[model samples]
Target: MKDNFYLGVDVGSVSTNLVLIDEEKRVVASIYERTRGEPIAAVQRSLILLKEQMDRPFRVSGVGTTGSARTLSGVIVGADVVRNEITSHAVAALDLVPEARTIIEIGGQDSKIIILREGVVVDFAMNTVCAAGTGSFLDHQAQRLGIPIEEFGDIAMKAEKGAQIAGRCTVFAESDMIHKQQVGYPLEEIVYGLCEALVRNYLNNLAKGKDILPPVVFQGGVAANKGIRRAFEEALKCEVIVPDYFNVMGAIGAAILAKEKTKRTGKTNFKGFEAAEMNFSTSSFICQGCSNNCEIVKMKLEGETVAHWGGRCGRWEIGEVERIAKEQVLS
Candidate 1:
């Protein structure tokens, strides 16, 4: 008999990650790929790779989607469960460290802090308006310094002292870094300084009023950076645990949710691996039916509308008007 597995996908502006787990909750495979502004293509590529990597006969019993593009990914993959990044990240953290009280999740375009009390989310804050404290900002700096981002941490570790860099905004930080370089500041000092600045900015912004407790888990693409991890440990004055699969924790959490949902429902809505070959398209249009003029996003499969959202009211939903028109015509 083929084994049953659960699939989870996390789609964000920076990256897309997919993970497969068995009924025992052990990870079978995990794949991470850059999204590069095309979430649909990214997801399709992930699914194709996942299908090809199945070494043994298995059936995908359930599917889950999470991250910034969770809704769109869920629609494309026929997810059995859909969840937000914070919820998913917290779930993964609690699984890894049941005593975890705080979760620091910094992604590509944004960062978030989740406070948990007794394994339940009590409060959360997200920094989406600024890019200064995100992976993208670090990548930008790496490019400017002509250094590979993968080597950023190791280089920072070599610094004897970190130079001060403004962390209030991306522009200011860039300006400060350029000035530091012009003054003959060592590359390591500048790099570590940027890491400290980013950590400070994250705390000052997202963790403003919250009481951050220990047993904190830092899981995200940024968590892979040793410099950022060291900065967090220094600032927090405590150890910050980074999961083995830090970069894909959101997807792991989503897979866990899908497993639980499937257990409860006794069935899954998974569209199957064949979905990778299907023609999917998404478009947006302004709904003029109301003063809101909401820009609604619609998803189509083979030229047929399947799902749509983005309106305050349900007036622009995919089936609302179509269903009513069919009823009127029949009557």
Candidate 2:
């Protein structure tokens, strides 16, 4: 007999993460892969890798999707639950740290702050416009400095005192870094200074006017940087908790949600491993239904329309419903 597992997929702008959890909510397997502007291919590769990692035969009891491409992922995987990034991150935080009051998530392209009280999310903010304090910017700086990003944190830790660097935006920060280097600032100090600057930017922007109480939890791809963690601890004057599965918390949270939903509904919508081999494609067009002119996206599986969304009105989604009903009647 095969064991049962819930699968979660988080397809972000820069990365695609997948997590599998058993009934007990323990992570069975997780994969993190670069999205590279191709979410569909990234998800397919991740799913194939996930199956290879599982040593025992198991059935995916439920599936959930979250992140920027949540709708597309749900359509591809036949997810039972599709949730937003904020909800998924908060749920994962609460599960790991029941007393979590704040969540600081910095991914490749964006950053967000979630404030919770008593296990419920009360307020949250996301920085979608800027790239100064995100993983991609840091990676860019590391490359410019000819340093391995993997060693960025340890090098920062060696700094005795960090030099001041502009934190408002990436351009100013990069120019300031070059100036500091020209003035003979130590490399470690410069690196740590960059970390500190990014943390300050995060606090000043997304965390402004928000009471960031402790037991603050930090997750996302950037959480792997110990230098940034230390910078956050220093700025907040509190210990920041980094979960064991920091990079894939969003997917983990989605899995937990899938488990809860399937348990309550007593069934799942998962398409099974065969979904890996299925042909999936997406297309978009301007609605032109009204002045709104919303760009509507549609996903097709095996040459049949499976899902559509992204209209201000429910026109596209309703069309999907009508199409399904017509198919049912024809069958």
Candidate 3:
């Protein structure tokens, strides 16, 4: 049987997730892969994996993308919907908790807070400058101590103490972790302390000056860590809810956007599952368009530029024939 599907791609700094949602919004097939400094390669690998999972051949009806690298990805896949991380995350949270007021998202490289009222994003904040409270930071410390990252949470759950570690910056936290380790502190104690430190940093940095209330949903890859979840519960002094599809919430949110956009426009821009079989190439160039000097990225098919993006000032977005004409005249 032929099927219509939507493609939702989230190109985060640490991972890339591709999700296929059927007309009914059920996730038919999903692929998750590490970005590992090569987003194109990661997406290609995810496509290959996704290509092998489908029972029937299908085509994309619409495609939406989000995350730190959304524009680059949207162009690569010929996406129909392109939006920011905050919008994408908010959309997903609203779908899960119809009346959710607060969103706490902590991933590998960054964290974000979204406040919603009546399903609309009223305020949002992102923490991209620090690493002390991110998943990768926790992973690195866990590895240094010869402990599995997954076990870090289990140990924290058993912690009898939650000492305050320097949480203002990553460097200070690292030295504090070493000192605690050398002092023969219990692994569980250190783990819980680290969790507490991260949560403290997060609230102070991202949730500052915001009325963070209950009916809160925490989503992101870090949402899987029970220690972080517990830390949030304690810090907020309120119940924090984690959605069922916590890790894939961004992709889920993108898929939901695709579904809604397609419904409204009565059309989709999806390129089918067969797109998985095609050979695609990607490259990047810097645009000297002012001090920003945006690094415009391009996705190629054969030799033609299928997509070009990455200019913060929109100096490199493709498909704008008029803009290109203006460029020619200006030059």
Candidate 4:
């Protein structure tokens, strides 16, 4: 008998991650690819990679999506469940660390802090306005320092004393780093200092006024950096747990959610692996009905409207297209 698998996809501005899990919730295969500003193409490529490697025929029992491009991806793949980043992260964190009280997720473009009580999410905060505390900031600094990002954390670990860098903003931090470099500071020390600064900025911006308790789970692309993890541990004076699947936790969580939904409903709306080869078109139009002038995104699958979103009042949705068609017939 072919084993059943659940598929989860997370599409963000920086990267797209896809995960396939079996009946026991064990990860079967996962892929992480940079989005490069094209989410749909990235997902299609990832799916194609998954399809090409199938050793035996397996069923995709359910599908789910999360992240910034969740809606669009959901429409493309016919996802059974579509959720936000916070919910997905929290679900994955609690599943990994059942007693976790805090979650620090620093992705490519943004960062967030999720507070949980008794395994339930209570409060959360996000920092999207600043790039000083994100993975992109670290990538930029690594490039400037002439170091490979993979070796960045190991080099930081070698520094005995880190220089002080202003991390309130990316601009100030870069300038400070340059000054420290020009003054002949050790490369290791400067890199460690940048890690500390980013950690400080994240704590100050997102964890401010929130009771960040123990059993903190850190998951995201940045969590792979040992220097940043050490910085967080030193600052919080607590153990930070980074799961084995830290980089793809959001997708895992989405997959788990889809599994639960399928079990309850006994049905899945998954469009199947052939969706990887399907053509999809998306466009945006301004809604002229109200002063909000909301820009609505429309999705078409093979020349037929499948989904529409991004309206503030829900006036320009999939139903609106059907209504308009009916009105045209009446006229």
Best by lDDT: 2
Runs in model 1 deviating more than 4 A are 318-331
Pairs of residues at least 3 apart in sequence or in different chains that clash in candidate 4: none
Worst 10 residues of 2 by lDDT: 319-328
The C-alpha stretches of model 3 lying farther than 4 A from their native spots are 1-3, 56-59, 284-296, 310-316, 319-331
Clashing pairs in 3: 59-272, 60-272
lDDT string for model 4 (1-331, tens) is 8889999999998989999999888889899999998988999999988777678889999998999998888887888888889988998888889999999999999899999999999999988567778999999999988999999999999998678999998888989999999999999999999999999999888889999999999999999999999999999999999999999999999999889878877899988878888999889999899899999988889999888888887676655334533753775
Ranking by lDDT: 2, 1, 4, 3
Model 3 C-alpha lDDT per residue in residues 183-301, reported as the tens digit of each score: 88887888889889989988888888999977999988888888888999988998999987787778877888888777777887565545555667878877877888788777787
lDDT (Cα atoms) of all candidates against the true structure: 0.90, 0.91, 0.81, 0.90
Looking at model 1, the pairs that clash are none
By TM-score, the better pick of 1 and 3 is: 1
How far in Å is the alpha carbon of 69 misplaced in model 3? 1.9
Which stretch of 10 consecutive residues in model 4 shows the poorest summed lDDT?
319-328
* Clashing pairs counted in every model: 0, 0, 2, 0
Q: How close is candidate 4 to the true structure, as a TM-score?
A: 0.93
Position 126, candidate 2: lDDT: 96
User: Which of the two, 1 or 2, has more TM-score?
Assistant: 2
